[model samples]
Target: MDRTGKSDSGSSSMTTMGMVFVKAQNTPLYSKAWTPSTTGGYASTCIFLLILAITSRMLLAYRTRLERSWHDKAINRRYIMISGQTEADRERQAVGKGGEKTEVAVLTANGTDERVKVVRSAGRNLEGKPWRFSTDLPRAALFTVDSGVKYLLMLAVMTMNVGYFFSVLAGLFVGELAIGRYTGAGEGHH
Candidate 1:
């Protein structure tokens, strides 16, 4: 081992070997984290975390684009009838029960029948309660996956491995660049 306690192989082999999963039991930031068990486990762990961080960031970026496109498509779509009842059918149904024409003042809950406008606003807001788990299992499952992966990637950077930390940082930077390239490249200006 050299003065820094790293092997002469210039791969920090000393620090690589026998690296524990938790350096400080209380503080995760001070923890020297490694997951591999092979002779070159430390290097492998670093590389694996690096790729995961990069891929996670990239997936997040693409998800944003997908959400945008989905919003656009949803807003543009024109569903004349929501519950299989056409507009004319609704109007006819809205007529007086006794076949007498009565002025039926139709007002939306938000006092606006402009569905597209409402949909656009809804997309911008995260104001709705989550759907029931029984009826929307996939939503909950995906939510857990997304949140868990994101947090784990963040915690991996706190391992304090120089290689691992830099890999995550570089991944975020490159992922942002990739996302910007796909999104409006010149939207920064008025």
Candidate 2:
């Protein structure tokens, strides 16, 4: 080991096997093409990593929003079915009298009939095909992008550059602090 605790294999390469964090400018981040040759280039790489981390959090927020929307739609559909009301009926009810928003109570009383209806509805919706092209395609695309960003960040961290690692961490912190509240409590962690 050398003075910096890095193994001295007489190779003089910028890459090291040491566990210690280094600020080497020649370190490749994410890809060989991203190797920084100057202080400015290194700083830019750190900033890019930070931005990428923040973007990952943003994608998570968007995915959460999309999921909530789907849940709301499902609930609305169930409500319509259980109440035996058409969309036009609901709209007319909403526009009744003084323009005040009326809350419609959902019937959840225990009964075999209601349970059977719910089960039938669920079965029809599923149709033994859980993956619908309309819904699952967008979801799969979002997951793919999210996974790609996460893996990219992981690769950047594997570079073992102190500044790059901290930049990504700071981005995550800032992103969570800024956009996390809108995603609801404990939603982004998953």
Candidate 3:
């Protein structure tokens, strides 16, 4: 009666919205008649995508935290003060160089002055004089490669930017979005 010129209730039908049954083969279009289950398909997809977005964001945050903790343990430290002597003086009291490399005569991390050999060269050479730096292990170590630790904290911000941008994009295109910032990214706080 509506479109095929027959009784409206006279066809093999499928239940749609409002419990109305319509002939699946003869339904003109679905936009006006899609069911709850059909709409829920898209909703469920969105929920799953949201869950995925959140999980990935948390995982990335955990990864960065672990990495930072490891880095902190590496550079947070103590220091040592060593005496200096001539390059050619082997038996002389070379606080840090070529003299009596005393272990207890300097301020240090373990509180014992241990002479550690540090080699710095112009570059790796085939046959150059090996310049060695002998000093008491200093307890003072810079938190970051830079003298200031704020530089190291930039890692946290950069990580946030990458994760945030991707999450926003996912929300817009994939129906998902989740992002989080870390403590290290705090204002003048790291």
Candidate 4:
């Protein structure tokens, strides 16, 4: 305005156009400008993705709990006397119904089967055994899925929108607060 000594409307309009483009830069993925039509749907999508990422993390915590529980049950066991011998015998000979010595196989938490001296008690059965830890194949598949989801959520957050990124973080924080206690993170804390 000072250089030309005249009021200019063109410059003001150009400034407004720049502001519009700057706002549009934050549009959600696979979306157009943040119009009324797209706003609700995009917001819902972001919230869902964030919740899914948080749920996956929580599930990972649950899996770890299961692993720890299994370890405690298997290795930290009480002394059991089988066939008139203690666990110090390493392997106990058990006579089958047919009077033949049989080896008892137990599935360890690590998905590998181990031979253990087992007593046939009323509380024990093959189908009633404790839940086994996730096998390598299933664990790998879960990791892949979780990683893919997290990365996608990160990318959505990288779009630099206040709504999407904050939603993701809120979900994570809320999930931690909700399930952290059951996953051992609440222990030994004041």
Candidate 5:
């Protein structure tokens, strides 16, 4: 007890009740509290976060690379090919009977099967000529970075890990706030 010739105050400093006191200093509450369970839990959390973060990063990178490669290929191709919208255009063009030129065919998004009816110069204004020819695409969706859509999707999909981190932080913050609020509420009751 030394200096006081009685006892140390720090050991009894946690709280006071007139002459009585409750000590919390040097408590075992958290001191050297390492344990197998705690270690395992920490390891598991680390592994999970690492896996999720890395996978999210890699998947986004791979998809972005793939998309870029596709756009590059499309750019290299000089021919304009419509897809998904071509067939419909062809059908609409052919509606003018056995003769006549069909106009305004639906452009398909797919380039492989662009069909344009050849109109013959007879019943229709024109004949034996394709109602529509898929025109050269000035640019593709993936190539133009300014499309605004792919970029947003890429941003969101690429940063899933960040979102998860935010979620964790939000949970922790909320928990602390709630605890603080409850503690304050109890104090007010006195």
Candidate 6:
């Protein structure tokens, strides 16, 4: 009841002070536009959240994979540069019957020298600019999408609807179980 002496019961459930942890249906999730008007609608929303969480995990896994691949390529490029291998020599070696091995001298801790065998393989030339628009642009786009999804999931959890919260938890649990072994520890959250 308000100062006007009129009933406010109709909108009472929709309004709350802050962060009500209640198992409620027909509640607004993220925005008023997503307010579920029926039990089935709420259930559907929960399912959608669950799927979103799983997709987020998948995206994280892909990002990790990309990072590793790029790291390896960078290392390869550095080795090629350090070895002073010319493009013509690299091309000839790559086209030859068997690739040649280069011996690199290593200094040991005890002032001893050791020789390491490095196998050179032909790959994309890394002599160009450090950042290429073709690769960096797509990586940036992927990062933007990944961040957007992560924040959207966070906002959904902030809704404080018990069902929705549990749904997200379940999805994360299931997604981890499915792809956890493939991804590194603590990678999913980021």
Best prediction by lDDT: 2
Cα error of candidate 5 at position 92, Å: 31
Q: Write the per-residue lDDT of candidate 6 for residues 1-190, one digit (tens) a residue.
A: 7755455874443333675787779779877998999989999999999999898888878887886676556546423223355656655544533333343435457662323224443344334427957568877987899899888888888878899889888888888889877677777564
lDDT of 2 by residue, 38-132 (tens): 99998898899999999989999999888777654543443223456666766675554333234454345653332122211222243333455
Query: Which residue pairs overlap in candidate 4's backbone?
Result: none
TM-score of each: 0.45, 0.64, 0.29, 0.47, 0.24, 0.64
Question: In candidate 2, which residue ranges exceed 4 Å CA deviation?
Answer: 1-16, 78-130, 188-190
Per-candidate Cα RMSD to the true structure, in Å, reads 13.9, 10.9, 18.2, 12.9, 22.0, 11.6
lDDT against the true structure, per candidate, is: 0.51, 0.72, 0.36, 0.55, 0.38, 0.71
Residues 1-190, candidate 1: write the lDDT tens digits. Answer: 7788777787755544444444332222324343444535656565666667666655555555654665555444332322344567556644523342323232467663522211122233333434445424744564566677667767776565565666677666665666656544443211
What clash count goes with each model? 0, 0, 14, 0, 23, 0
User: Candidate 4, TM-score vs. the true structure?
Assistant: 0.47
Worst 10 residues of 6 by lDDT: 112-121
Give the per-residue Cα lDDT of candidate 4 at 107.
41
- Candidate 3 — worst ten consecutive residues by lDDT sum? 134-143
Q: Give the poorly placed runs of model 1, Cα more than 4 Å off.
A: 1-39, 81-143, 183-190
Question: 1-190 in candidate 3: lDDT tens per residue?
Answer: 5554455787654443443333222221223342224544534433443445444445444545654564444333222433454435423433433222333343456764344322222222323332323211121232222223233223222333333234334543332123356423532221
Q: Rank the candidates by lDDT, best first.
A: 2, 6, 4, 1, 5, 3
TM match of model 5 to true structure: 0.24
Measured with C-alpha atoms, the lDDT of residue 67 in candidate 6 is 68
Task: Kindly list the per-residue Cα lDDT of model 5 for residues 109-142, writing each as its tens digit.
Answer: 6643334333333322322323222222322432
- Between candidates 2 and 4, which one is better according to lDDT? 2
